[model samples]
Target: MYQYDAIDHQLVAERVAQFRDQTERFLNKELSEQEFLPLRLQNGLYVQRYAPMLRVAIPYGMLSSNQLRTLADISRRYDRGYGHFSTRQNLQFNWPKLEDVPDILAELAEVEMHAIQTSGNCIRNTTTDQYSGVIADEIVDPRPYCELIRQWSTFHPEYAFLPRKFKIAVNANENADRAATQVHDIGLHIKKNAAGEIGFKVIVGGGLGRTPMVGVTISDFIPRADLLTYLEAIVRVYNQHGRRDNKYKARIKILVKALGIDEFRLRVEEEWKHIKNNESTVPAAEFDRLQSFFTEPEYQTLTDNPSNLTEKLADSTGFSRWFERNTFPHKKAGYRIVTLTLKKAGQAPGDATAEQMEKAADLADKYSFNELRVSHEQNLVLADVQQDQLVDLWNDCKEAGFATPTLGLLTDMICCPGGDFCALANAKSIPIAEQIQAEFDNLDYLYDIGELDLNISGCMNACGHHHVGNIGILGVDKKGEEFYQVSIGGASGHDASIGKILGPSFAQEEISRVIRKLVDVYVSQRTAEEHFIDTYRRIGITQFKEAVYAKAN
Candidate 1:
């Protein structure tokens, strides 16, 4: 993790003081609700259904042991004894008092963390692969670029208030895109040209909310040095021309759609010509300065498959299953990246209790080089766990209720805090997620079905990223009653696609059965070794829709 320098420290301290004053003014009636809206939002404070929700940024989803402990302490003292890890790789405290948020900010500042750029209509947190530097399949570490963007975009004077919130994702891995770059406002796919020079394959206009669109490749190749300048050009074009009349039509995706990719590319190119050679073009010194922070940790030299690990896997089926599902290949021979699932049965997805957070911090310190990562799927990662220590770590995780061994299964769902907490939501999402999890509790059945991404959103805001799920579920309200809408064939990766709706919505109670029918259809239609999404794409959603509705009819 990058430790804050003196400038970083001072900047965050000043911002905290400023927000404290702003909050005090609002509470004292010196500032009205409308007047304080932007101020509070800029500080990552949202007025939810019942109370204020404070979103704290985990830059590129990286965290240190100290930072994790600080978050756990914040959860224990300020809000309810838990915090929700969001789909954007941020953490949200759902019940923080409005007056207490400044103090919370101050606490976060002590640990080199903040809420800045986590909310409001500005450049949000820049996320990347959770296994950025450690994964074997990466082309280059994306964290330095993500960090550069974070620093560049933070309180940027020109882009403080864009037409709408903008998101950016960077992917260095050629095989998989865990960051789901294709669905972000700006997706940077790091690649090497024919001459072997590094550059980005820039994709623009992708988003998920009301109007879902996969990004179009605006530039086939932009040199690494020109990344920031090119990005500035794109945002400047959007800021100058994007719609301000309607909130729904303000996102960069809408502007890209209206202008067409060709015209949009032309405008950006024109803007880039003015600044491409300027300070915005990252200098070699700056690249070295940022890259120095993300250099590989000191790792011990050991074999890829240690005798102890092999023996343990051979002896215990439980250990083998957990290893197969929860762990990922690492670049280092002796190490593995482990995902500690937050999706326990009966618990809301991504909601980690204070105790669990503290436990995770301890575990990270003890076994994983004192570091952790927040995955886009709303799970935590120990990116440098030793292969030989897997059993002990698994035992500790099992004790803490995180050893689910259902990483890509149906039970490991991505969900949002819907109507229960969010004012924007039309229907409750947690109860629905819980019901589905309960219905799919059988591990044997889930394993037989293979990998499935089931995402649920409260409404069309797509906070759960329901648009990209293999089996997407959206909660809808029908005459004050909550109904669930189902979609199929959506995916998020190198080949991302928005899910297609499968006819009418179902009642909350009927949703699990609907999902079961959809799964049954997949099981019956799928060829050997085919995943749910593959089968859905192969056979199409028509049969699944028919099966689901036939039961209802």
Candidate 2:
């Protein structure tokens, strides 16, 4: 984790003070609701259905155990004792009082955290692979670059008020893209060319909202040294030309769609030529400085396949199932990356109680070098857990309700806090998610289905990233009645694709049954050893649609 210097501390403290004043003015009636809207939004405060929601940034989803403890403390003291980990990898406190937000920001500042850029139409959090430094297939650790972008975009005067929110994701692994880079406003695929020079394959215009788009490749490669300048050019072009007349049409994706990829690329290239060698061009020394913060953690050398681990797996079916679903191979032989699932039956996806947060912090401190990561999939990662301590960790996780063996399964959904919390939501998402979880509660059945992603969003804002789920559920309001729309074949990663709508929307009660029928179709049609997505692509959406709708009819 990058430690904040005096300057960083001062910046956050000063911002906190400013927001405190702004919040006081609003409460005192010196500022009206409309007047305070942007001010509060800039500080990541949203006036939701029942109370204010405060979104605290967990930059690139990295957190020290100490920081995690602070977050837990804040959640307990200020809000309702739980926080929702969002798809952006930020934490949202749904019940925070408007007056208490400044105090919350001040507390966050002490831990080198803040609510800045978590919301509003500015450049939001820059996310990357959750398994960044620890993954074996990675060509480079993308965190340093993510940090570089974080620093560059933080209150950048040029991009502070874009037409709409901007997101950027970086993926360095050739084999897997846990970061979902293709669905970001700016996606960077890091690679080394045949000449062994590092750079990025840049993609632009991708986003999932009212209009879903997979980013188009603007540049096959941009030298690593010139990354910042190149990014600046892209944002600059969008900031200048992106529509402002209609809020619905203001995003960079809309601009890209209108101008076309070639024209967009030409504009960015022309702008880049002027700024290519400017101060924004990151020097080798700067890269080295950032890289130092994310160097490999200390680990004892051990065999890749530990004998005890194999023995334990063979001994306990419970342990074996959890291990298979929750753990991933680390770059280091002795260490494993463990995902702590926040999705449990009957609970909202990604809602971690204050106690659960504290426990996770304690576990991270005890076993994983006191570091943790938040995944875009709404899970937590202990990225450096030793294989030798797997049993103890699993037991601890099970006690804390974080050891769900449903990663990539139907029940482990990515869901937004829909009509329950978000005023923009047309319908409730948590209920639908819970219903689906109940419908597919059997572990054996889920494992048989294999690697299914079900995502739900209350509206077209797509906060749940429903557009990229294997089964995407979007809440729709038709003639004042809530309905759920289903889509299939969506996927995120190296081969990203937006799902196609199955047919007409279904009533809330019909959603779970529709999902069950979709699963039944997959199970019936799939070939041997095929994943849900692979089978869906092979058979197309027609059969699944027919199965779901025909049953309803």
Candidate 3:
């Protein structure tokens, strides 16, 4: 993790002080709630259903042990002894008092973290592969580039007040764990050309809302040095033309739709003429400075040791199951990447208790370097765990409620804290997720149907990324009655596409059955080795739709 220098420290401290004053003014009745809306939102404070929720940004999902400890402390002191980890890899406290937020920001500043840019119509948190630096297939570490963007976008004078919120993602691997280069406002995929020049494949105009659109490629190759400049061009174009009349119609996707992708590309190209290589252009020295922050840790050189772990797995079925599902190949010779699952059966999808947070921090220090990563899937990552220690780590995690090994499976769902916490939600999402998990408790069945994304949102805001899930369940209100709308075949990776809705909504009681029927259809129709997505694409949603709804009719 990058240590904050004096300037970095001071910047956060100043922002905290400013927000403190603003919050005090609002509480004192010097400013109206309407007047304080943007300011509070910019600081990541939201007025939710029960109380104000304060979201704290964890840049690129990277964290130090100290930072994790800070989060644990914040949860213990300011919240209800827990914090909700969001799909964007941020943390939200659902019950923080409005007056306590500035104090929270000040505490976060001490650990080189903040809540700035976690919300409001500005460049939000930049997410990359949780395994970016440690993954074997990565082209290069994506965090340096993410850090560069973080610097360029933080309180950027021109982009501070955009027409709507904008999001960007960076992906360096073909695996797409970051879901980078997806349907973001701007997506960048890092690659090295045949000539050995590093550049990005730029995609623009992708988003998920009432209308979902996959981002279309706008530039084939944007050189590494000009990344910031190119990004500025994209945001500038959106800022200039994105609608302002209606908040719902102000996102870049609407602009992208109105202009057509070809024209949008041309317009961005025209705008790039003036800013392609200007002061905002990332200098080689600056890149070097940022890269220094993300240099690989001193890793021990060890011979391949797959024997003991293989033998252990062959003996203990429980260990074998966990090892197969929770581990990924690490870049180092004898290391592995491990995900600490927070989605145990019946737990809220991303809520980590203070004890769990502390335990995670302690384990990160013991098993890996004192470095940890919060994944966009709302889980924690131990990026450099040794292969030999996998069982030991798993045991510890199991004891601490961190070892479920259900990554990318049916139970590893992405769900928003809907009606219970969010003021905008029309229905409850956490219970739906819980019901689905209970219905699909068979681990072997889940592993058989691999790599399926299940996302749920209480409303059309798509916070759960329902539009991009292989199975998207959206909550809707029909005359004050809670109903769930199901969608199928959505993807958020390289070939990002939004799911199509299946007929009418179902009553809350029917949601789990509908999901079961949809899964059953996929299971019955899939060819050999076909995943849920592969089967869905081949058979389309019609068969699954009929299977789920026909019985009800």
Candidate 4:
């Protein structure tokens, strides 16, 4: 929501122009594929299995209705008539031509958006709770600080080329919508201490791959003002000492593991002594300037429950079903947080059509305050919708193919666009997701399963955050055959932890049955009030593995 200032605008324009020239040179043969790799990556371009792919940044997953409309336009005009929203809350175009990238970026700049840092070994997009300002439980809105990191990390000269890609997340809410701050390269949970001073409880080096590890807490409290300074120290230490010889071993998680958390903390503290409150730390004036961008939208006064809509829903079970599942609490009275369900049973998860996109934009304009957000779970949010208009909104959404009542259910899956699109993927993920959805078509069963985040990725890049789902599935290719791997005990929000691998990979045909077994294990092990994640953590993955893997073997 931060509007670009003159300097911000100019900087982006210049970057666009620079990328345009770089793209032109690459297309003209002035730059080879190898030569253009890093340049294009810094601009969020990737040469995928088919054509080139471009990822556009939706910083912290917040977008205005104008931005959404712009995205729809870009998808229509630039590539195919659609774009893939990625797990990191960014958008990806699978068929972008190298020659057209510059123009694409120029268009994005006009909307105060860019592709910078969406990829590459440099600091990638700084993510935060999508419901930051609107969520009732938040101690403080984390976007201002996120924007501060955006400024400090953007094209930072010294840290521009790190050994591996880095990710950072900020979660201010106790519920941990941003995940438990667990598998990110760095996670920041913004909180106020007993003294009522704001600071971050920093987690470092948790990631998933061939070697997966939970991030260790490095600092109990990093004073709010010195957040950037402390972050710089962490990255600098990683940049200087993280394994550079082997690309596979280059993430901060590896460095933290090798040095051990105690020594890593000590080293970071020593480094922080010099940089703790340097120029990079966000000053008070800039913080206020950024905060102004997220001012609350105007709303009309109304009752908590509207009689008319309640009466209508009272008659129709269908309408009530959707209202119950898709709606969440909003900070404002008479306003509710509406999640537009992207999961239609048997459909590829999180795939929205162009018409669906437009309908969302229109709804954002008509009912919400011309603002929309994309959740990490790959769903869209109309953060503030009036209670009176809920039924009408649901009807319109239903007509537009946007009304599905599967929020936080098994159907509401987090998935990466796997082998169908991403070259890095080892197997196709969408079809597997469809198969699982088909197997568990009973809504009551899924709802009874209760708030399970089932995530899948084609490979270990963990794009779907397969590492943190209640049921995490990773697709692996064994020899010439495609196989799916299972992990359990993963979670993203409030109590984030990377899932443990269940055992060996399964043939693609066995995936659905494996999932069924995992679910049955949960049903048997869980108590009255425990969610899937709570049950998984309480009992551990051993029993689940015994149920699913032991039989398969």
* lDDT of every model, 2 decimals: 0.93, 0.92, 0.88, 0.85
Report how far residue 517 has shifted in candidate 3, in Å.
Answer: 0.9
The TM-score measured for candidate 3 stands at: 0.98
Per-residue CA lDDT of candidate 4, range 1-553, in tens? 7888899899999999998888789788999989999999999999899999999999888888888888788888878877777777788888878788899899999999999988888998888776778878899999888888888899898677999998888889876565446778999988899999889999999877667777889998988888888999999899889988998999999999989999999999999999886887766787788889888888788788889777977898778888889988888889888888778875567776666678789999988898888888888889889999998899888887778888888878998989998888999999999899899888778878888889999998878888888889998989978899898887766566777888889998899999998889889989999888888878887888788867433
lDDT of 1 at 109: 99
Candidate 2: lDDT over CA atoms?
0.92
Q: What is the C-alpha RMSD of each candidate to the true structure, in Å?
A: 0.9, 1.1, 1.3, 1.8
**Which residue segments of model 1 deviate by more than 4 Å?**
551-553
Candidate 3: segments with Cα more than 4 A from true spot: none
Model 3 alpha-carbon miss at residue 319, Å? 0.7
Candidate with more favorable, higher TM-score: 2 or 4: 2
lDDT of 1 by residue, 1-553 (tens): 7879999999999999999999999999999999999999999999999999999999999999899999999999999999999988999999999999999999999999999978899999999999999987888899999999999999898888899999999999899999999999999999999999889999999999899899999998999999999999999999999999999999999999999999999999999999989988898799889999998888999788889899999999889989999999998998999999999998899999999999999999999889999999999999999999998999999999889999989989999999999999989999998899889888889999999999999999999999999999998889998998889989999989999999989898998998999999999998999999999888887898889878433
- lDDT value, candidate 4, whole model: 0.85
lDDT score for residue 66 of model 4: 86
lDDT of 1: 0.93
lDDT of 2 at 453: 89
